[model samples]
Target: MTDRRGVVAKRAEDLMPGVPYVRGWNRARQSASALADQLVLLGLDSDFPGLVADVNVVGDGLVQLGTVRPEAAELLATLIAAGLRAELHGTTAETPATARREAPAA
Candidate 1:
């Protein structure tokens, strides 16, 4: 179990580039829990229903959307459609401040 968590942690870290955007999304209107709910709903409605089972809201509103999965791109697209400002892992350097500024008001 510990080893699995460590692997998951590493995967989360690899997915960290999207954190700032998710945090900013939370700050703009929704809460981390709300975002998690959205993720679950989206997962359930999508082809990869189990792709997002372990969504966690970590320190300072960072949303960890579990480890990598085969539907990563689709998940990112779903999140963006749901108003999350995200990019493919390394494609974004957007900070929380920037995303907050860009986020639409709730």
Candidate 2:
């Protein structure tokens, strides 16, 4: 499992190579919302209700799936079958410290 911090840090570094942070973040969030809607339309909400509740965007190109349930694999497989690139990042027990850490200033 890859460290969540490292994954977050890498994403932070690579965020919007030439774009403004706010603009980039807003774009990503919008895209994530659209993707989430698409997933719902694809019946993921019905197929894996619990897992679907945990899908969220933490950064550009970074959709975080916050679950350790076995169904997560099935959800990922479904996403991949739909031609979406989905992969497991490391899992960690979420805590206040981790949750409160802000992304590095751009």
**TM-score, each model?**
0.28, 0.39
**lDDT per residue (tens digit) for residues 9-84 in model 1:** 2222334444553554445234535655655554432433333322222313233344445455444554464443
Each prediction's RMSD to truth: 14.2, 15.4
lDDT of 2 at 45: 44
**Which regions of candidate 1 fall more than 4 Å away from where they truly are?**
1-30, 45-59, 78-106
Clashing pairs in 1: none
lDDT of 2: 0.43
lDDT of 1 at 15: 43
lDDT string, candidate 2, 57-93, tens digits: 2333444444434554454454454342222433433
**Which candidate leads the pack in lDDT?**
2
lDDT of each: 0.42, 0.43
